[model samples]
Target: MPIMFGRTIKRPPWRQCKVGSRDDLQVGQALNNKVMELQEQDFNFTIDTAFTKEIRVERLPKGFKMPTIEQYGGTIDPEAHLESFKFVMLFRGASRRHHVPSIPLYLEGLAKSTEWFECLKPRSVSSFVQLGRAFIANFMSSRVDRKIMANLLAIRQRSNETLRAFLTRLNSEALKVWDLDPIVKFQALRSGIRDVELKKSMIMDEPADMHNLFSRCEKHINLVEVLAAKQEKEREPEKKN
Candidate 1:
């Protein structure tokens, strides 16, 4: 049994090449292994047309699929449009899409959705990056920040809207409005909350500050929206009958 026992051994290629220098053998071995790995990965090696004898490095696979505009609607609302644009860019980043082709694809998607983004039309753009810059200039207006700040300062809960809807819109705009005074912002937000019972309860409690007020209010508002949604869903079946 001891005589039959054996150990497998591994060896590097040493005798195949002239090995003029000690490092040459190691370098050649590394290159050969790397080429084998690339072939296993299905990387393509092509002959350089300009230099008939020269072999080009293996090319990487193109994995990105261009998204359709129908998947995400047009830029009818600037805020909603910005959200969609960000989502698309994030999707591209995750897919490892090259920016050169991606920009045109983005423009094409936008054009397919609506003619409103005329500046980003594919015909108008010669450079892919320039189209992106022009897109920002046109759709994502710089004045939007100022407008949001103004709206945050002046917003009031509309008569027809639910407490949840009003607060949701307020919070969304408030996030974009930079550098607002906390006290002033809180006051504005509270004034817009139209739930009279909730307001009366807050007044009775007299919470120390806005943070406390928000914590108390958000819970109540969420409950109200949930109940309302449930009731609406229940009514839908009765209406069908």
Candidate 2:
């Protein structure tokens, strides 16, 4: 206490306080803990808000079962995976909004796809079509041994192969060739036939288009089958004797 103007005045408690006191240290610790708690709360709120905004969930039709699609691991063909994804989504009656956001759920083990999706700016992907194009562009290198026009032309009918089997193989090969010309496909089929009589017929008649060519091939295919059945029937009599 000090005398001021003949009146006794008590010193303030703060002025008498000492540094490194146990109570001071305890108060400091309490303040630090409270600040950390507030920071953690803010962090959690930010994460929840961002997640809610990013993913838009839609209610599916009652009792409609969702189809299971294989997860893409970035090592396989991206285009094929995307096609499969779209097919299942379409089958499930999912709209464009469902497609754009649901892609991340199907992706796994692919940093390029999963991480890339996470880093994308909000609202950058507008539709499924845009998302598909971007996905293919990113993973195009993973596709192996893509077919070319020459692969279609190189297809040949085997010596022992039936006309029907040969035609099926040729058609399958043609489907794999991208942007194939109709005339080229017609000529390739004409040249690849193994049967001498059928090849002669095709060369002599020179079918107008692919449809006409297939019609001519179908006649030969039927004749071959009929002859095969007749030969087998004859062999049955020899076995009996």
Candidate 3:
């Protein structure tokens, strides 16, 4: 029975002999290392993609001229200065120069005598808009000083000035104080007129606002000038005949 059992215990289906060294066991580990390395490379690639998306690469235009506020007729109007600068930027893009270095170029446009230039001298600016606002505030303050605004409000039509010339002087001074209330502005302009007929018409029937008043006054002044010119022409013909 023992012998039969021993015979029945067939030789193990296969002989157990080691075919590889300890280094061979490391093969699986090396494969795992390779997989981790690939994962790391993918992670780095993803980071680079995200970084590139976040940063904008602006190329500067060739031979671009920087715009200055003074170049646009020395305006104290912040809106005018900023708008003109924006127009330049728009033109540059239209000319195929979309991305340009802006900080240095914007600084170049600011007046050296301006407080904005002095205030920003030691600072690093990242945005042109922010710098522009500062410049606007500084320039506007200079234009709208209390004394200047007061002078504008106190302006009277000079005795020797024609209606057109007086209006021009008044408008030039008023433009410097851009923040006055509309009603106040209209009253100031109305008070300065020397023409009794116009003043009576204004008092009897006030216009809707300053714009309406200005339009009516302008038309009246133009009509007066036209009549005067016609009279002069008629007199010349009569004299010649």
Which has the greatest lDDT?
2
The TM-score that candidate 1 achieves is 0.37
Model 1 vs truth, CA RMSD: 18.4
Candidate 1 structure quality by residue, lDDT tens digits, 99-131: 323433444345443333332322233332443
Candidate 1: Cα lDDT at 24: 77
Could you tell me how far off, in angstroms, the CA of residue 229 lies in candidate 2 after the best superposition? 8.6
lDDT string, candidate 2, 28-50, tens digits: 78878986665445233221122
Which candidate do you rate higher for lDDT, 1 or 3? 3
TM-score leader: 2
lDDT of 3 at 87: 76
Clashing pairs in 3: 59-99
Against the reference, the lDDT scores of all candidates come to 0.55, 0.72, 0.59
The residue-by-residue lDDT of candidate 3 on 173-223, one tens digit each, is: 776665766776677778888989888889999998778898889988998
> What number of backbone clashes does candidate 2 have, counting pairs of residues 3 or more apart or in separate chains?
0
